[model samples]
Target: MACVYSMRSSLFWMMLVSLTGLAITGCATSVSTTTDKPRLAQQSVLSTLWMDRAGEYRALCHQAFNMAKLQVDRRLSYHRTLEKPLAVIVDIDETVLSNVPYFSQLIDKGEVFPRGWKVWMQMSTAQAIPGALEFLKYARFRGVEVFYISNRSINEGLTATINNLVKMDFPFADQRHLLLKSKSGNKQPRRDRVEQTHEVILLIGDNLNDFSLIFSDKPVVQRNNAVDMMSSEFGKRFIILPNPIYGDWEGALYDYQWGTSSAQKLKVRQQLYNQ
Candidate 1:
């Protein structure tokens, strides 16, 4: 009778454990089934197109570099000062460094600017832009000084940026050559510092602020006017790289209100679109 009672108790406990396991499994399965599916499947169409035309994109980069070289030569020739030492100011992200992978990651995660940008910069896994390495090498061999002027905040990812650039074997990877933003978004002070010592013959970047910080926070019409005023300088003293991902142009359209909520921003964008 004692043995029978013990067997019955064990059976009861085993049945209770089995039932509990089954209940937990059912709940998990139901929760998973109720989860929402991803809206857009696969990579973004724009990113796919960019990847497909990468070869052409690279060729264009080479062409742009060749043009820049020619312009540099002309400027030096015009000045007739071979000993003056030519200098080129380049923007880091999206200009000389390719952050397509980072952008793709953001798209895959269904994320956008500010949050996505902070993550991308923190990752600091940006590769050199196509043909940029070759151009920098050529420029170095030709005795031209290279400087990188980026708007990335100095407080964030500063060390990571240095390490990533060094890892990529970028020319002028020295700390002195890198100029990051201080507390202010204004870059003119930094540009002025570079201009004080160097001639700054060529300005290469994917953004307008990279050329002249004056137009950094200007309105759309004013920015357009500023560009028109300096039209001759562009493609001559300035070589712009392509960056369709994000730019100040978008900021201008949104009135540069980065503090505004996404819903409010979207409403403003919708109104502009309707106009």
Candidate 2:
């Protein structure tokens, strides 16, 4: 009887050892698999705050639509006797669509602008901005035309942009209404074309360049002065949207030079902050 009990204890010990060995082997495999795997970092506090406050964002959209409606009404009233079609020029990204997801993807990857920006634009998955769809529909109902004046370089993605707009049910006419950046990155030619057929009553965008090509290449101080000059036009014939993600503001601060190395750019940015 004693011998039988000893044999059972030995078998139990053997099984315990085997299980422990398996567990260690499995853990080592897992560690090896995850050692060099990529992972996204956490978003910044500002981004988190903005994303968390859905109610505020909705209110902002409402305000934007109200402002747009007022401009549209004013334009229609002014062009009541004009033989030409009444139209409004609107910027696509940030002003008419939300590309937060694309930016968030970049943030997750611990990346910054330029490369990420190119990739985001290439994806062309930007959805309509909050209240933009409603405002466009309202304008359409009022017999006003909407033109998308984007700085997105003309390329294979142009078709994708149009298709995405259609999918989102935005009021888009064909290639005629979509103005892309020319080789010069100047928007005046496109604006000229729009003016030929339609009297532009209001211009809406998150950037000053959307309204006119004047400030497109201006320095920071000059740009501010230009904005001051046009301050009176804002909220009347111009509706500016809020965009904190990226803009010409960054360009001006960085000397409008894109060919500089990343380290040099970082140094310049740091110097600006120190000043």
- Give the best candidate by TM-score: 2
Candidate 2 ranges with C-alpha deviation above 4 Å: 1-54, 116-124
Error of 1 at 145 (Å): 0.8
lDDT of 1 by residue, 1-275 (tens): 99999999999999999999999976544332211212221324475357436687777677778888887677766664644567899988877778777656655765445546776777768888777887887778777889888878878857778877888887888889888887876777888888888788888887899888667889999999999988988788888877655678878987898765444455566678899
Evaluate model 2: give its lDDT.
Answer: 0.75
The lDDT of each candidate is: 0.75, 0.75
lDDT by residue for model 2 (1-275), tens: 99999999999999999999999976544332221212212323365347435677667767877898987887676565548888888888888878778767655665555446666666657777788999999999999899998888767457777877887899964687898776766777888889999988888888888888778878899999999998898888878877766678767876788554444455566678798
For candidate 2, the per-residue lDDT at 106 reads 57
> What alpha-carbon RMSD in Å does predicted model 2 have with respect to the real structure?
13.6
Candidate 1 residue pairs in clash (backbone atoms < 3 Å): none
- Model 1 bad stretches (over 4 Å): 1-56, 78-84, 116-119
